[model samples]
Target: MRRTFLTSMALSMGLAAGVAQAQEKSLTLCWAAWDPANALTELSRDFTARTGIAMNFEFVPWTSFADRFLNELNSRGKLCDLMIGDSQWLGLAAENGHYVKLNDFFEKEGIDINDFLPATVYNYSTWPKGSPNYWALPAMGDALAWVYRKDWFARPELREAFRKEYGRELAPPRTWDELMEVAKFFTGREIDGKVRYGVAIYTERGSEGITMGVTSALYPWGFRYQDPEQPYRMEGFVNSPEAVEALEAYKALYECCTPPGHSDAYMVANLDAYKSGQVAMQMNWFAFFPGILKDEQVGEVSGFFVNPRQNEEASVLGGQGISVVSYSDKKDLALQYIKWFAQPEVQQKWWALGGYSAHRAVLEAPDFPESAPFAGDFLEAMSNVRDFWQEPEYAELLQAMQRRIHDYVVADKGTAKEALDKLIQDWTEIFEDAGKL
Candidate 1:
């Protein structure tokens, strides 16, 4: 009897150990979790509950996201099992072959990717569209638009004053030109015995913040990076007549309205300014909008609208996507995640957690416009959003463009024409090297 009891106890212990091993192999996910990233994780709770996997999440602020992600990737599969990288990293990651191409898996799993917003998923998740493979899954919803002090806009005193100056009723400016008119009207205006600023234009050269802010203006001015084939190349369109025209307009607005040292600004910089009532408006991401509303300090006065257009409203289609590391040993598990996360139910959970949906159906859900704190504004404003270049060399092209434009507008270095011609020349050369020109 004693021997039989001991044998049964040992067998039970062995079975339990096997079950635990199968359940938790350990998963580490790395991402940028500012508001959007946070929202994605909240959406991921269901996956954790259902799979019984021991998941580890790695989140870094956007401030050092690139460096952090790059370092982790370079660590040779020790850093993470899953990664949701920035759109700009797509090319470099793909070129380096450090990411598991999901095309085969996606097809084998029968994921109808056609349901995703093509412009967004293609640009942010693929290195070169139509290539044999895709690199990641859409991780966040992104669009560029202006966030303003709606409470102030709705104020009777400000409204009357704006109408008197612009010869129109006080309302969201219909165009970029009108946005300037609005900025100038309230900039430096006396309010409750306090001084105020007109607008916040990101000017900081730190990281990619300034670059993103600059491109929000540059692209609509008809700036093209290179011939379509040579996407990585840059040219002198930086000083083009059109390019300069865009900068000149931007410069005029900056001069009269932006806070001091606005040139060194980034996403958070502008948010800080708006939160403090230092700047009346800023061009920023959809992801940040939720945070502005959540933070007690700024929620009282913040407002949002689609990025205003100069000739038309066109903002960079920017955001991040979820991907599996090429060297990840547990790729099947990661693919399971990608497939499950795309479900409408999962998307709705994400929405409830303050995330924007990547799918049109969820974005257009009848209750969405009314349920969340600011869904009405976001859904109404999605029409004006657009995608930036998602090619592998996307950052190189953007940096090249930023350098030229920053010099011209902030430093007053050269005629827009001179800068643009040189930029165009530079970009054309890059195309030639790529055999695209």
Candidate 2:
């Protein structure tokens, strides 16, 4: 009888221990497979060391990142306890309750949203445009920027020829027209007896690549979605003549300067072109700048600049915010991770590890802009950052854009005017279906 009782007690204690261990299990974070994700892995080691909660990551390629994660979220898969979602995903995620509203959690934990950059929070965290509803914590702060081969641009012979012909010094361009001229000069030019192309921009057809890349040209040339006082009234706003001109300029840049077989190019393809010495210049997200600055061949020769202006300086925002999956059973544990990440020290380490920290304290550090080659450009670009649609129907809208823009830019099927007109029609259909128009 005594032995039986002891055995039963021991079994109960063992089961309890098992449950406790399971409760303290590792967290899985999903994000795009890129330079920042690598930095995240390194930065997370300290979190694990302090909390004893192992960190697991799901790094999906950017091309398919949205499809994979959105499916996971919609299915309420427990695979990702935390996710670094794109800014445009906030509205859909929040509206559908896929992400936990962070307002109460942030306030309870004393995590001040003011500490993060206003642009980051507005674009990445908030829903309903300027509402106080917070669905995510800004993790990565990014914007479009230009990178060029400084060594080639600085060559006196090229500079002299450029000045003589184009009547301008061969240097980083300050305007899109000047950039086009520079790109023209470098296209198919022999550098070190090897022919290289001029520029590489995102032209990938099946995803958000083309839209994101083209917006660098779009916003500066006067593209606006709708009246600020009204939403879903996009007919004239989207297909305006200025917007048409911008898209034409974008397609022209694609045809004139990019390498052959560049139709499916995005982040990886652009990085490869620069790293392999295949292109003289590239336009990419600022988040990739840290990795570029570390590349052996490209780092020493490269110069960084904000995307050149057309009629004004503007850049497309490209970072993501970390959100807790609403269906996650481990919400408490996820909140713990958020609290840890919000600390100023951790944010500082994030930037040091090549992740762009959105925390104002870290970004505003007196030496922050000078900390890296593209740092100043990043600061300047973020100040003028603009975002695409931030509605619950964003995915539908983005897909429509991908189809229309790709048909024109990559497949060469139609003119910019026709493309934007079709885009306006498509967006109107989506808004109508959503009962917005």
Candidate 3:
């Protein structure tokens, strides 16, 4: 009787241990709470089904996303097994050991970083800029692009009026000067019994909104962060005559074309303005393109285009890389997830589910251009993208630019040249402090 009772106890203990092990097979992926997050949640179900591992998510709003996740990473908290961190965070995360370096794991699993888009791999994974030291995988590919009201542009009266005024067909502008002309023509115009503004640009003062928006103009007007040969030297390149002109042009657009009371507008605000027929065009990231195309009110009328060219073609890069949190206990499980996600078929499905896939196999496929109305434009924008500072001091550098540019462009505090000059001073001090100078 004693032997039989001991046998039953041992069997019960084994069952309990099995249940605990099964529960431990789960992973939590953290990212911003947006349309792409919802798509990722759906796509992860396939990962769970294939590996018998449950997926968990802790998504935060965009406004608080960086602060929340950075705090978690800084504290070495085990909140997330995987993190889809912003591209700008790569330098800090890698240097601070917040993310696991996956070079060996990638090699063992036969995952080629080369299979991803070169721009994404360069921006999203490498810590030392163009080095091979990868700490993440490019999960979402994005760039700043324009979406205009095609239905409005196609109107005969408007077309003839625009042609007469600008000496060109009322089509998407291929140059910044032409874009300005188009904006001037559309501003204060009545469309469908409503007064419509020319554009909804990124003028939000509080965060990275305005910087991203203004950089689109700055890049085409030949702005560079530093002398390519001598890094951290910002005087000539950052505040050049061309860059000042670009800044002035951006300010002009904001003052003359944007909707009334749009002094502080960002992605959601711009989207709202465009959807309500308050604006003729909106500048936004391609990540939101899928949702915009599916929007009930403005979906059918919207047409996409790459950023207009000036002295050069360029667009602001926007996206995140997926990284394994070094603090997590489930490192092996997180690696498995990355391995599974790198598969071409899975990446194609990721795109289908509304998440931008950075894999070349998905992007370069013959059917890719026809996959969505905005796909071709997305490809074009990604090809000539530029990113802000990705050093460990990225936040400091970004904040400095934000203050200087916003004071000038929105508050009307200084001249374009003065703003850029002050920006150079701020950046020089930062780099000097970090001993990069």
Candidate 4:
């Protein structure tokens, strides 16, 4: 009887220990459902193999990504141990305690922020813009970039026609004016017996699409969110002459160059249009470039370039940083994952696996530019990239820009000046309500 009791007790204890171990070894990472998420999943297998930590992923489509994950973070849910969140969410996540500050962990692990691209560090990791207060590690680096049909540009007949008309070589555009001319040249032309359009740009109104697209044009044309000297004072800056001209230029491009009924297009719609050979050029994030290069339809014929210069060179920043969820019980494991991920070898492997490594070791390698067709353009774009407001009230700021810009650019409801003036009014109200004005 004694032996039987001892055996039963041992069995129960063994099962409990096993369950505890299993729980400690598992982790969940959340991000938007996209190519990079898949790459991260593939790359994480090595992490699992090395540390014996199991990783699970929950990926939401981009349309609902911010809503779903922001809600998860706001509600203090433990569904995710790690989150690869958007750059614009850093301030909100840090302020709201959704992300665990990784500064001390980084220092303890000798993970230097200087080793990552400066733009990624600034946009993705830092909460106070240039401060050293880091709530995340820059995981993927991306920017708005242009891709065109190389074969179309190389056609001798088209080149001759473009040169005759525009008095310039038929190459990728070097400036905004040149870009518009090229876009116009291709807007209604017949290519390979099919009618093709000039460009597929962001026009989607519901989310951040139009804001991103409009800002690409706005940035090069010298748009500023507010007076840098007097913070949040957006009166002259947001509705300045340069900014109004940029807005007008974007609206004109949309009306004259885009495909029929492209008023509601964003990333996926642009990708589909490009793949279907409906557009000669497309503006999209560098995160999609890897898949674009491997695409069966237009891969071989595609070429990429940085956003053209206007008054200055600039591109809209895109990408996210990986953070440990502050509410997670598995913080130790999540931190371990960060340490492992920050290694030079791991970063190199990440790049090889189609994940954009912000690590300088990977980006500055001798052969890095030659590693991918778009790598050089990606580097250039990152160097001159700018991001949207990263304030805790970023959603309100973005929504206002979206409404104002979409109404002007897509719906043709007002003049550029009127649209921007209304935007400043909207943003001013938001800031005043937040006590920041």
TM-score of each: 0.87, 0.95, 0.96, 0.96
lDDT of each: 0.73, 0.91, 0.93, 0.93
User: Model 4, range 68-129, lDDT digits (tens) per residue?
Assistant: 99899999999999999999998899998999998899888899999999889999999888
Greater lDDT among 1 and 3 belongs to 3
lDDT of 3 by residue, 261-282 (tens): 8988888999999999999999
Prediction 4 global C-alpha lDDT: 0.93
Off by over 4 Å in 1: 1-24, 130-132, 227-240, 372-384, 425-437
Tens digit of lDDT per residue, candidate 1, span 342-402?
7778877776777777776677667767775557656645554555455555555556656
Clashing pairs in 4: none
Model 4 is weakest, by summed lDDT over 10 consecutive residues, at 18-27
Q: Candidate 4, residue 306: CA error in Å?
A: 0.4
lDDT of 1 at 135: 87
Sort order, TM-score high to low = 4, 3, 2, 1
Which 10-residue window of candidate 2 scores lowest in summed lDDT?
227-236
- Alpha-carbon deviation at 183 in model 2, angstroms: 0.5
The local distance difference test score of model 1 is: 0.73
